[model samples]
Target: MAIAPQWEAALQAVQSPPAQRRPGRPRATGHPTDRYEAKRKAILDAAARLFTLRGYEATSVRDISREAGISQATLYHYTGSKPEILAAIHNLMADELLPRMNGILQSDLSPERKLAEYMRAEMELIERHPTYTAAMRHKRWLLPGAAQEMREKRDEADRILDAILQEGIDKGVFHPFNVKFARLAIMGMSNYIGTWFSPVGPSTIPEIADGFARILLQGLLSASPHR
Candidate 1:
């Protein structure tokens, strides 16, 4: 399946050879990766907040450092550069998201159930890390190197979704439609949760996921193409 047209330029840029990396401080602990991961998470979380608050282009390293409650040099100690930081935010999402996608794909559940679970998993991740999800959702402005590196990590979800959708379509479980558009539409609806959804508000993630899945399936299961 084709990616959305608007990302073509960004895709082309990513196909080229990527630049080399600037290594950060070596891992300090022998077993517990959490210390390093936690620090990285802190930097990434701070960057996510800044990235979403101010546009990625407008947000600066200094802003991220300040938001993260660290000196600029300390920030660099945890992260290499701005693009790397942005990439880390998305990578963090991908790291959490892909496994759930895989699990849903592999399950014996019906397409509708699989999809409902997918939404639950995605929104749960988003709810846990809303700014991070929002930053990744709205921004695609990474360097060629970072972008190239991230392509597979990010696209893995789409790949799984395509497989699921195609399988459902083949089995006549879901109505025939453009798989790419369907994927985009489903993801588009969920990604917006970062902006409007609130944990303390009326709807919970599971409820929202079920609601969204029901709404989408209503259209997917529609008998008439004219609708």
Candidate 2:
């Protein structure tokens, strides 16, 4: 049977072993700004991996330290607590994702194209950061105080999408629908990509992006009664 073009490569990447985990130490003073940023990114990456694989309640500071190759004290130095680490993980995701989403909002593309671009971008982002995806999967059920700020940031993200969808309606590019429901449906489709998408599989990122765009556009585009 022919494989679906949407998820093949993502599936493969998920199954493969991740690269070496990041260590827990701060960068040497001499390192470039980008290098310092890279190390911080690595720590967050490792924290996401551990927090996702093991529930927030079950995963300990030591586990994150071990996965990140740093001392627990060092982890504390970077981020005060495991809860704080979770916050940082979600913040990292928001930092990268929201701006790209904002860019899409401002583009003059057709509404359907914009929607498609958003979905495709969302998938690519999740695939690149599966650990964040995992944590997000359980976001509502997260331990108290662990995800509050992240949730706030995510709400802001949703507002951006809501505005775009509203624009599509105002412009007659989409059938009028409740903005909240529309936003949920769009996000549901893309956010779930992390649960299944793999980078090593047959489907390339562009392919998956294109496929998702088609599906979303088909649903959202204003239809012509005449075929």
Candidate 3:
């Protein structure tokens, strides 16, 4: 996740703003909280687009400010630095997906069905939030202290998947294998959708999800002793 040197320099510059401001600043007319949130969302939306379309390192704070229709100073008021903007984007994805995923994990469906549903749910999330998912997948290294928290969230998801795999093995529904490796394999396949999937592509999200579930749950090899 090492950000490009240029982006690293931009981050450093944004982090260290001038200590003084000119006198006679104009006062706000609207409620501070509402105005603040609106501006924050605008910055995040703009940053997500830039970070996804252009690499995080290549996208400057000025670029984000222009895209957001706010001055660089105003952007700083909402987000302290470029890294904070990136972190907020990651947080947005986590806030949207984690609770739903927890619910999926707690569902009473059999492990096999649960896994398929989980895969479908993830695919749907990616389809709905392509920018956010792309940022999560690609710019994770830009998050400094927050990277550990993100990893913890990922580990939590992994544990849920591991539980499903173990339950399947316990019930003799899924053939035994290394559960950890299996979880990684399944996750690797699903997480990669953001890189190449398109809404207008040949197949829909559900079609891809179904295909992925079938491949993961049912082997490609014929009925054999290994299976």
Candidate lDDT scores, in order, read: 0.75, 0.70, 0.73
Which scores better on TM-score, 1 or 3?
A: 3
Worst 10 residues of 1 by lDDT: 10-19
Clashing pairs in 1: none
lDDT of 1 by residue, 1-227 (tens): 23233333433432333223346865566656778677777778777766665668878999877776677897898897988888777777788888888999999988878888988888899777656665775446887877876787758888888888777777677899999999999988887676567556788889999999999888776364321
Better of 1 and 2 by lDDT: 1
Using TM-score as the measure, name the better of candidate 2 and candidate 3: 2
Candidate 2: where are CA atoms >4 Å away? 1-36, 138-146, 224-227
Q: What is the TM-score of each candidate against the true structure?
A: 0.75, 0.77, 0.76
Q: Please provide, for model 3 over 68-139, each residue's C-alpha lDDT reduced to its tens digit, 9 standing for 90 to 100.
A: 776899899888699888888877777777787778778888776788878877888877766666566555
Deviation from truth (RMSD, Å), model 3: 7.9
What is the lDDT ranking, best to worst?
1, 3, 2
Candidate topping lDDT: 1
TM-score of 1: 0.75
Clashing pairs in 3: none
Model 1 misplaced regions, further than 4 Å: 1-32, 137-140, 222-227
Per-residue lDDT of 65-162 in model 2, one digit per residue for the tens? 77667677867877768667777777777888888988998988766667777777778787676667666555654457656667777888898888
